[model samples]
Target: MKVTRYTKADAEQWDAFVRASKNGTFLLQRAYMDYHSDRFADHSLIFHDDKGHPVALLPANERDGVLQSHGGLTYGGIICDESMTTPRMLEVFDVLLEHLRTNGLNRLLYKTIPYIYHLNPAEEDRYALFRADARLYRRDVLSVICQDRRLPFQKRRARKVSQAQKLGLVIEASEDLEAFWAILEANLAAVHGVRPVHSVEEMRLLNSRFPDQIRLHVCKENGGIVAGVVVFNATRVAHVQYISSSERGREIGALDLLFATLIERDYADQAYFDFGISNEQEGKVMNVGLIEQKEGFGARAVTHDYYELSVV
Candidate 1:
């Protein structure tokens, strides 16, 4: 395979290839990746087969001589199609490392696309990572619900949902960013002491670009937003990208009601529903209370891993 450095001229082909990739999500698309291009030194690459047909794409960025695939996204690696066999993956890695070394990059940080996101069996990169002697640096666990064979929601969560229902909250899909972001920002500041990854303007722009893929669902009380979640919809998974609740919302279990509506009514048809990550500090610590709340909704664990590879 011939490895080619990505260029703006390659955007069309790059996006087409990602659409056809086994594990590709809209997050891997140029439309999504380029939204914050100004913040990252993009070092993405495209691989062409012997006949000059594209085989894979690496969505990556370079920082301080280390290449992350990619620092901007939650998870990314070699985005390949069904043609990616184990031996072929090894060849790709060999070429990838050589390309990195030749380009003066000494280390590569690879973030894996979790299995639940795969359109087909796509674990060849894992086997190849073992061959390359990559080190596991981080592992974040996401709470996921398998739709068809879902486990029953814990009684505790059920009770909360019931309580929330008694409050007469309205749950609906919305385009209201101001109300939701206000609640989200305040909640994050008070509880986590951090801010949302995307600014209100940035999120609005993204929503406009991919309205169907990115959605906002709000739980409101008397036309005022109390709790909300931003869900990123993919072929097999509907991932909760952001979630927050106001003090009033929490007291009445507003989030529980919102999630119950999503899991049972809104996204019941999806194969998996991902409740983002619970681990912090580069996966060293688990937030027990947060994860237990997700588990109460019958969501189980799915790990997203990061590997460090020596390219020198």
Candidate 2:
């Protein structure tokens, strides 16, 4: 086996491999990862077999002598295709550790992709991590609804949706990012006292690049946007990347209406509806109110774990 650093010249090859990888997402693609290239020192890796055929890839970055699978993405680790086996992954990690140590990196942080995102059964990396004596550093709870056997929404949530319907709120696809950004900015600031991770311009650029994968859905009242969500469609999973509501929207339960329509109509065919994470402070703190709201919609927990491995 052999390992090599990723380069601009390998962009096409990298994207092709990601598309075929069992647990890979579009987020790992070069176009997406490089959106904020000025921010991180990328040190992604590509692994190949003795015959020189590409076998696996790692979307990662290096900072202060520590290599992170990818600090910018929701999850990142070894991405491989169906051909990858437990032994092969172990070998890959062995070579990967050697490469990192040779480059003077003393530690590595790995984020495991949640199972809901997998196109096939691909958990060999977890076993490999255990074999490598990696420590569990963090574990976040993701609220998700299994579309095939979805649970009924709680009575209060159902009532809210009914009330929203009675108010004649319109749920539809939207192109008004500026308007939604205004609502998102205000909502995040008022609730968390922080701004959005992505600015309007950056989101617009990403949406334009991934037209089909990225979408905006809004609940409107009297021709004005009241609430909205940015869904990142990743094959089987419809992930809510951003969700927010205006004051009036909340009063009238616009979010309940929007989510009901999205889950039942827009993305009903998808396998799962992921509401992202509800943990804070590296999973030590649980936001009960935030998670309860998601749970009201019949969502349950799926964990996203982070692991640390010593390179020395």
Candidate 3:
């Protein structure tokens, strides 16, 4: 087997591998990667057999001596073909690590996907063999609303949705993202204790690159902004990319109302509603409960594979 850097010609194969793999994430999509490639200081690598058919893929972002498996990618690591035998996976990993070390990388972080929502068993086992020490991170709880709509509710979520509607909440989809970004950034710092993932330029670029895929859903009340959500309809799944609101939003159930409206309109036809992940490291308890709130709406939790590798 041989390992090499990815090229423009490999786009179709790369995406095909992702679509076929059980552990694939939206981040591995060609369009998503290309949309944010300019922000990262690295590239992607693929492993192939003598037949030259692609078998495994690793998209990493490198900076200085620290090498990460696609930093820009929410989930990263060696996503391999499920049919690959353990021996083949080990061999592929060996070559991949050797390449990284020889290239002056001090450490290799797999950023092992913690959720296996759809990973093939063989690919998951490959990750198991290489992981050294595992660090438990925040969980990205998912809900299959369409599959089991009668989920147990801890609070009156559905009723709240109705109340939000009664409270004169208006949901609008528009291209005016600058207003949303301002609210998002401020909310991120205040609530999550972090910065927004995308800059103004990056968001604009992505918005232009994926117009149909990206959408800004805002919930207004009393003729002003109360809450807003950035929803991405990448495939069959409708993911809540980002959500934010002001002080008044909490009082009037603006957020709950906004999400309810967005889900009804944007994700109404889809089967899955990805509420995004909660960062436990950031002391985000309210958000953690919010994930559970989604579960109340008949959402299920999906876990991914998280792996770590040491030089052998």
Candidate 4:
């Protein structure tokens, strides 16, 4: 395999390859990855077979002599199509390391795409990372509900959903996201002292770029927004990218109702419904309260991994 650095000219080829990859999602597309190009020093890569057909692509960035498999996104790694096999992946990793070494980057931080996101088995990179002796640096557990085999919500959550239903909280898919972003921003600021990674404008731009892939579902009370979740749709997954509710919304269990509805009816067709991660401190600390809420809705643990490699 021959390796090449990604450039703006390769956008079309990169996105087409990502779309066909077994493990890649729209998030790895150049349109989505480059949205925050100003923040990250893009050093993403492409791997081609001897005939010059792209076999794998890595959505990555470099800074301070290190390369991250994209710091802007939730998770990423080597994106490969059906043509990729274990033996070929071993060579891919070898070429990948040499490419990194030649570029004077000595270390690589790789974030693996969770299995639920994969359209097919695509863990060859995980094996390659092990062969390269990559260090397992971080592991975050996503609370996910396997829709077809989903369990009923806990009694408390069920009661809340019932109560919220009586409150007449109307759920609708919205094209405009600013109203929901305001609620999300306020809730995050008050509860976590942080802001959402994507601004309303940025999110709107992305939604416009991938309208069918990204969606905002909001719960409204008497024509006012109370709660909402931004969902990123993948091959067989419906992942909650951002979730938030107003104080009054929380009081009435608006989120419980929202998720119950989404899991039970709205997104029931999706193979898995992810509630995002409940860990902090680089996946070292588990937020019991946070995860318990997801578990109450029949969500179980699915770990997302991060690994480090010494290329030199």
| Over 4 Å off, model 2 | none
The TM-score between candidate 2 and the true structure equals: 0.99
Ranking by lDDT: 2, 1, 4, 3
Which stretches in model 1 have alpha-carbon errors above 4 Å? Answer: none
lDDT of 3 by residue, 1-312 (tens): 888888889889898998887667666777788777777876588898999888888888777676678877766677766677777777777777788778777666666554333444544443444353434343434444553253543467777776677877788886778877888889889876998888767878877877887888888877777788877764456677788888887777787777666566657777566776653442234365766667766666665434445554
| Cα shift from native, residue 300, model 3 (Å) | 4.5
Better of 2 and 3 by TM-score: 2
Candidate 3 has an lDDT of 0.69
TM-score for model 4?
Answer: 0.98
- Residue 268 lDDT (model 3): 74
| Pairs with steric clashes in candidate 1 | none
- Give TM per candidate: 0.98, 0.99, 0.79, 0.98
TM-score of candidate 3 relative to the true fold: 0.79
Per-residue alpha-carbon lDDT of candidate 2 for residues 164-248, written as tens digits (9 for 90 to 100): 9999889999989999999999989888999999999999999998989999999999999999999999978999999999999
Model 4 lDDT tens row, 1-312:
799999999999999998888999889998899889999999999999999999999999998989999999998899999989999999999999998888899999999999998888999999999999999999999999998899988999999999999987898888759899888888889888999999999999999999998999988899988889999987789999999899888898889888888888889999999999999998999999999999999999999999999875
Query: Of the pair 3 and 4, which is ahead by TM-score?
Result: 4
Best by lDDT: 2
Comparing 1 and 4 by TM-score, which wins? 1
Ranking of models by TM-score = 2, 1, 4, 3
